[model samples]
Target chain A: MHRRLALATAATLCGALALTACGSSGSGSDAAGPAAGPVKLTFWSWTPNMDKVAAIWNAAHPDIQVSVQKQASGDDLVTKTITAAKAGNAPDLLQAEYQALPTLVSNDVLADIAKQTAGTKDRFAAGVWQQVTLGSDAVYAVPEDTAPLALYYRQDLFQQYGLKVPTTWAEFADAARQLKQKDPAKALTTFSANDSGLFAGLAQQAGAKWWTSSGETWKVGIDDAAGKKVADFWGGLVKEGAIDNQPMYTPAWSKALNDGSQIAWVSAVWAPGVFTSSAPDTKGKWAIAPLPQWNAGESVTGSWGGSTTGVTTGAAKAGHADAAAQFATWLNTDPEAVAALVKEAGIYPAATAAQSGGALAAAPEFFANQPDFYTQAAAIAKNTAPAAWGPNVNVAYSTFKDAFGKAAQEKGDFSAALTAMQQATVADLKKNGFKTEG
Target chain B: MSTTLTDRRRTAPAPGTTPGDAVAPPRRTAWIPTLVLLLGAVYCLIPILWVVMASTKSSGELFTTFTFAPGSGLLDNLAELSHYRDGVYWQWMANSALYAGAGALLSAALSGVTGYALAKYRFRGRTAIFNILLAGVLMPPITLAVPQYLLMAQAGLADSYWSVLLPSIVSPYGIYLARIYAAAAIPDEVVEAARVDGAKEFRLFRSVALPMMVPGLVTVFLFQFVAIWNNFLLPYIMLGDDHKFPVTVGLYSLLQQGANAPALYTLVITGALLSVIPLILLFVGLQRFWRIDLLSGAVKS
Candidate 1:
């Protein structure tokens, strides 16, 4: 028994030592050897048909072959990418949302590609370009697509209600009220607290820079004057019961849009794509207009969803940074690539030159009634307000969902929810060891 | 012999109740417990029913139709799912089967050996090892996904089939179950008799202990198979290639195709409805083993 105990103890110690050695040896050793023959790169993206678009490039560029690995999009993808990077197993290229750039950059998942992507800045709009640069000299990504905000309303419904298309927030409110008086059961639109991106875009159109960094300090302005104005305006509408306070993207919301219970949507360029499936019964009945302005005569709009193709730090360590950056640039700017992206992936190219012609020259099938749909979208896209993002946008966005979701359900003060969002965002930034300013 | 004893015990009435009372019919059925059970069944089945009903609807009709109403797009949805990315959905289905099927078989084999040794042996540090495994059973596998991914990365196995299979093969709960089942089902005297007969240890276990532990091992296999089949986070984090994704991750990728495209709700619902068929078939096929009591033909008291 004694001898067996000694043997067991020795075996246990050896097993424990082996485990610890395995754990410790994982650190360091990120150096890559010299490449040979053709360079193969993997790209992670959530865009549908991205592989088809990449296949176009792969056929042209035989030396630097790129493959697209599709991923589920959203905030979860950001966390997944960061985790993969920490393991030094990140893909060569990643398609990231414009807002998630700061988080990825701060995590060191993305590499600075300004040197490789030089002379491509003129390809995108100024505001769209600013997002990829993050107000820095280093460009972490190339802008692939932009979703400039617009108002999509039912032309027949508006005409029936004798309501004019709102060009300003005041007129929009009046129209909502007028529609409510005409039919109490029907709502003109809804205030959806479920989508933080929608609220952020609305606030951006009001000129609220929710996140801005200078030197080494970050500032969170989620409850600033412009933010409060936008919040209060929507709050007043929801309080008065002029519009619905329900969430979007729900089955009920889809039913409403399909059956014309809710007649208008303050959405972005991608609304047509959503309507194609969600409100298929209402095909060709919707028309696009610029998002109602905060003040009259202002032509500014905000983007809801857009993404950039960024080269990962792992790609750089793997000696494929230049090849990845070249693909990223060509994926967004090259006329052939962008057109294929538009045709196959159904993206609104951020490149100004490509946004108007080629694949987008004809309106989307769902918007066949509106012949100049892309023209109107392009005009709105030109005036997109610049957006600022911090490393903790995910935190702020979740808080927005919780705080504002409650406030909207209760028809309570949204300004208070906005304050909670700001406080939570700042606290998170500080907790993450970021220097924060009010 | 033990089955007869259990049968007699089940038929025997309560000790406090007289024979006349046992023969008497109940005044009324237990409506409250019956109602509660009905509610529970509905609660568990509503989501599954919703998936079934929703899968039949076309994309346009999915949200517009009534909740339980069936539509006419089941065949279309199936075709779309089959043709998606040139039948990548089937690839994901095959990958799920490989991960769950092979992972469960290996886990059951490993658990059988470890559990038999722990239960039947009198070796030093046996209690310590068993206790460690108990602690492991308490630890959720989701929390260890990132650590496992990192370790797999170090071994140059991160995106490979082995990365997922390796971690899944060492299920603590499976071993724990097998140990308890082994101790109760296999009597000490049987092993002593086999020893006096000069049967080797491996021969004794293979011929005697393994046969007795079949029911418990089947339970473990089913549990591990279902756990691996429904696993999302492990494979989601470990594998970067979509072709290697299970149906859960593949359906998610289809649903969340960025803000540019509408979610493929119909395809996802159809995929979900199809994915559960294998699990149901597996349960229906293996359920007979669970009906066999562990000590059915063992020594009488």
Candidate 2:
């Protein structure tokens, strides 16, 4: 029995070691195989309901087959994509968030789409298109979806408090005060203590660019006058107790939204779905309007989260950039594809054609049948100034979130936090081997 | 003897009952200890109960409804989960079973051999080897995992099942348990007698020591099984193919999607609930060995 046990144990160890040897050898053979086996291309994306987009694309193009692998969202997706690209195992086409483009560009993992594909520049909303371009001429990705900021207010709360929808920052602050006075338990909405992206969006609307390039040298001004100006506006409101300070995406925040403890939310185009989904009973109790202006008559708007489809340098090595680039552009801007993203995935499309006429253009039931709410969103997407997120935006954004909270609590003393963030960003850029200009 | 220990279990001192907190045996009623055990069990079970009730809620109803209230969406949730990615949840379930079942079995057998050898033999560097093996437990899993990924990538095994399965086989904690159990369970006299009867070293161990060690080794197997079954970070860092992922990583990916599209929350909740059922069943099923061993000193070395 002991002899038999010894032999079995020895055999198992040998088998395992042999299996390891086989696995190590097998990984290299797949990448070197011929490109003729049905031209199967793997596409990675986090956007839900992309099976519809793949199905539509597959039916038209029989020679090139595409498979969409949904990944985790945001920074996680960026980490996975860059690592896989470094490993030479990345997908042919990948969906990147608009903010990740600068990092992806610096990592040298993206293909220049304009150089690879045909005329596709006129397909997207202008501001959305600007987000994917490097410097001026190098287009790195096709804009898939955009988030133009807007105000979603509770109509019932507005009526109960006898307040008009505030159009300008001054009027909005005044309305905020009046509403807070009416109910000490209520505020206009919660200022997210954790979202620096929102502050960046506000700064973008105020014409502050966090990163820009002059010739070859990158310039970073994280705490510039524009950022401070925008920060001071929101900081003063927060300090005055006009807005509640609550973390977004928490159970408490959802409870506040559901129970009408909060009266409004300044959100991008995609946030309405979350509000309606989380608080379905509030259907027809809410209404949409343009973002309250920074200046009384000015119409500038900021954006939050959006994504783009980009061809990677890994795909370039496979010698299928033309086909991949065509698929990338078509996935975002094509009428049927954009419709799939909008209707099935609940994504706000970046394509002007899809945005112009759609089921979305009709009055939404959640917003009390507001006609032309989406039209206002589409209008905001055009001619709005785009911010240049630096290559280190991911790190900078997280650090900025911490500093923004401190600044908001400092009673309009935002300049200190802005300066802190600027110095920190400059230090990080220099550490990462970038020549930075103040 | 086993019955006496079980009957004395009320006075066996509860998990957190320290030496200083001990009460005289004659001072406390049996009810006090029973209540304390029941409290511990309930504390462990409430989250599971909440998950069961929460999985039945629709996305909107999740926030609005009382947490413990069972909603009407159970069948809807099950149907949606089955249809999601063509029932990829089942694939994750199967992958988890493959990793845990196969991994624990191999680990238990190897632990049995090395643990018996360490306990019964006094070879050179035996203490050094044993101590080195024990030190592996001190290394954080992430520190091990990152280096494992880089090494696996270089080996061209980064995304393979073997990448997860191979690393899982070496459980230092399991081996430690096995060593202690072997020493306590097997008698030196039995081994000497087996050798006098002309039994080979392997035969002596196989016929005498292994059977006596089954219940204790079962504890080792269960530990490794649970450890591998719920492992998240290693597979998350290693595997690219969702098809190869264990349920934890799979559910994590699902939850990540839930962050952007909140409607996916119901599926994530349902998936989390379903994932727990197998582990609960496993714990309940394999707990008999622990009960048997703890009831009596089943074997002695």
Interface DockQ of each model: 0.44, 0.33
Residues A292-379, model 1: lDDT tens digits: 9978999999989999999999899887899999999999999999999999989999999998968999999999999899999999
Q: How would the docking of model 2 be graded?
A: acceptable
What is the per-residue lDDT of model 2 for residues B70-146, given as tens digits with 9 covering 90 to 100?
99899899999989988988999999999999999988887788778777776555676678666766766667776
Error of 1 at A39 (Å): 0.6
Note the Cα lDDT for every prediction shown. 0.89, 0.77
Residue A162, candidate 2: Cα error in Å is: 1.9
Tell me, by lDDT, which candidate is best. 1
Candidate 2 TM-score, true structure as reference: 0.89
Candidate 2 residue-wise lDDT at A130: 79
Candidate 2 error regions (>4 Å) = A1-23, A26-32, A359-365, A405-415, B1-26, B29-46, B121-125, B200-202, B258-260, B291-301
Residue-level lDDT tens digits of model 2 in A72-182? 676866876676667666778888888899898888778887876457777765677778985678889998887777788998889989999998878888988998888
lDDT of 2: 0.77
**lDDT at A184 for candidate 2?**
85
Q: Model 1's CAPRI class?
A: acceptable
RMSD of each: 4.4, 4.8
